[model samples]
Target: MYPIIRMVKQMILHRNDPPLSAMGTHVSHHRCWPWDIDLWMELNNGRTLTLLDLGRIPLAHRIGLISVMRQKRWSMTMAGVSVRYRRRIRTFEKFEMRSRAVYWDDRFIYLEQTMWKQDGECANHALYRSAITDRDGIVPPAQVIEAMGADNTRLQAPEWVQGWIDAEAKRPWPPMQD
Candidate 1:
């Protein structure tokens, strides 16, 4: 089941936070629960992605993206992601998550997120490509920016992020066909 209750808790916890600029980072704390673990007694990879949402969604809210989406009847979707895990999080262990928008092109917004252990070591990091959409189809980032009244500052993705984007462009789609 989706952790809807945890998500609502996160939403309520950050409800009074001051608004942030579109590119500003949001920091949040979370703990791994027994249910979040896999058989290896560490945080499950899939649950890690779900927990990242505790930061990402509030990030969208702080940047006013959620409000704009609600008013414009638009929706957001994750188009792709790349994650690297380096450390294990045991049940009941606390960690901090940081999330921010790295850049955006005409088509998509790129977000970077990281999880840090209590000792300050990075547990994992992820880069996500997100798209805003309407009933017609995917909405352009430019239009989304205009709708949010955000400064249309052009941002260049970092070299590593660009490399990932380039690599993804070359990857074959719909694999394993008979």
Candidate 2:
């Protein structure tokens, strides 16, 4: 069993969250795979952003910030997602991703993320909701949530996100179908 003292220490030290861009370096490219374009198209379509492509930049930043602030390990499970694409982003283009915490409920954390092209134009943006879970899928103790102030009750979908979702729903499924 995990020690209570260690849990308390982690809660106190790692709970201070930071913006995702502050944690790691930007990524420029991934080798061409047959599905690369499809994946990019999906991100642009606003359904859900794949975690794999989120990369170490955003992940390291968010995890590091949360660890530093809460002093504990935060295991995350994706709950929901929404994304918008402002411009076409290709496979080899250099890009940057920025993310910040939007809110947290007793059992969930929400984050707003944006991806930008080398020219600094918005390529895509997303709202990601995640739940905190243990390796065995157990929820964290109440004391941990209270210590982190993870009691937000005012979460709402942003206006731009609604628009993006609508637009994506209307997009042709297969490019050739249009």
Compute the lDDT for candidate 1. 0.94
lDDT by residue (tens digit), candidate 2, 1-178: 2234433443444345443333133332222222435544433332225432344223434444345334655555666676556777664455565555555445545567766767779777667665666555635434334544544234554566455445656877666642
TM-score of 2: 0.49
Range of the 10 consecutive residues with the lowest summed lDDT in candidate 2: 23-32
lDDT (0 to 1) per candidate: 0.94, 0.49
* Residue-wise C-alpha lDDT for candidate 1, range 1-178, written one tens digit per residue: 6889989999999999999999999999999999999999999999999888899999999999999999999999999999999999999999999999998887899999999999999999999999999999899998898888999877788999999999999888976688
User: Highest TM-score, which number?
Assistant: 1
TM-score of each: 0.97, 0.49
Candidate 1 residue pairs in backbone clash: none
